[model samples]
Target: MSKNLEHQFSMLVREVRKEFVGNGPKEISTRFVGNWAISEMKGNLTNVEKFMISSEQGKQMVHEARTKMVKQIYKKAEVVNKFEALMGAKVLRMFSDINIDEDIAMTVFVFEQSIESKGK
Candidate 1:
């Protein structure tokens, strides 16, 4: 597990963040374990977006919007190619979720095979 692998994962996250949010988060951190990479996003929302996601209903709405965005983005083969290139592993699945209370989002990327040692 090279730290560079974590950095590559973080870069992939920031790139994807840009697609959905028009810009990357203030910070993106990633950890690799087994066949999974977990990305933590900070400053994931603007002031107005924060207000809109303040309540339970707002949170649900935002969650659904994020889900839709994920689906749409996954349709781009270039995006998938970039992911595989950066990860050095075939992506099996991806999951994204946001916590309005924390103003943070976490995305999990599961690979068909382990990337833990591939980047080393």
Candidate 2:
């Protein structure tokens, strides 16, 4: 991607990710891989999240729950449309993962066309 488009994509990714997380992350970064936009977020855990994820079993449960939540969100056409609008491409797929213990998350949004191709 060109510098301008890269910057724009990064900014939009951060904004959208903040909305997804209910609040913005303490730190966030977005990168491109083929036609995919990969966003990573790190933040402090909410008290409820912290309390619920105290044990190893609890951590696994919370992580699975987070995965389910993201899958549900991606199932919505409106959500996909919103991302495509922001990303300037048709979205092909989305995948997300979270680490409950580290309070970190990674989400990848795949577009039908490469971002670099669009930039050129």
Candidate 3:
């Protein structure tokens, strides 16, 4: 995919996350590979979340909540449809995880077809 296309996709993802998560990552980068779009995000934790992660139990809870919240948001038809339209392919599944210690997150979107080829 062209760099411009990738940037646009990243921006869209950031905006969607901000809308749902209340705060978006400070930075996001995306790469298209085969039928997948992989996004790496940095500075995803809020100040309160950062404080909460000081304790072992708080760390686990924050990790669980952050990861599960992302998955739950993707379950909404509007969210899935937005991604499908952006990729010009049906979204098969979405997987996401967050690292509380690093304040980083990774989100992978699987498309039914080769979105990388389509972009080119």
Candidate 4:
């Protein structure tokens, strides 16, 4: 993704974290993945597959959740503008193979992204 999009995604993650403070990074990771309807697709999903391809409605719900999360970060922007800013962009893509300790993975990725961007 472009740096601008990556920055925005990072900001979204930060805003999500801020809203869930004291619940800690594990809670943030849970929230981030909360709306995914991948379980429905798991009937066909293989152990090697990281993501589940879902129905249109499932995808729509996921989109809406992402939008809601982004809006929490950039509330002053118009809806269209916020959607444009947040859509299809990520600073760091979460792994398809979830680690045994996924929360640790998420916290590390978030901190790494922030640290890497500091001097840029």
- Which one is best on lDDT? 3
Task: Give candidate 4's total backbone clashes.
Answer: 0
Weakest 10 consecutive residues, lDDT, candidate 2? 16-25
Candidate 1 per-residue C-alpha lDDT over 1-120 given as tens digits, one digit per residue, 9 for 90 to 100: 577879877987787778766877898888888899888888877666778876888888877887677666766778878888887678878888777678788888889988777756
As a TM-score, model 1 comes out at 0.85
lDDT of 3 by residue, 9-61 (tens): 89988998999999999999999999999999999998899899999999999
Candidate 3: residue 38 Cα off by (Å): 0.1
Which sections of candidate 3 miss by over 4 Å? Answer: none
- Quality of model 2 by C-alpha lDDT: 0.74
Ranking of candidates on lDDT, top first? 3, 1, 2, 4
**What does each candidate score in C-alpha RMSD?**
1.9, 2.5, 1.0, 13.5
Model 4 clashing residue pairs (backbone): none
Q: Per-residue lDDT of 1-119 in model 2, one digit per residue for the tens? A: 56566666666655655567565567777777779888787883556778888888878877887788777877778777777887678988888888776788888888898875666
lDDT of 4 by residue, 21-67 (tens): 31212222221222221111012112222132245554455444433
Candidate 2: where is the Cα deviation over 4 Å? 1-21, 117-120
- Runs of candidate 4 with Cα error greater than 4 angstroms are 23-85, 88-104, 107-120
Q: Against the unseen true structure, what C-alpha lDDT does each candidate score?
A: 0.79, 0.74, 0.90, 0.32
The residue-level lDDT of candidate 2 at 77 comes to 82
Error of 3 at 80 (Å): 0.8
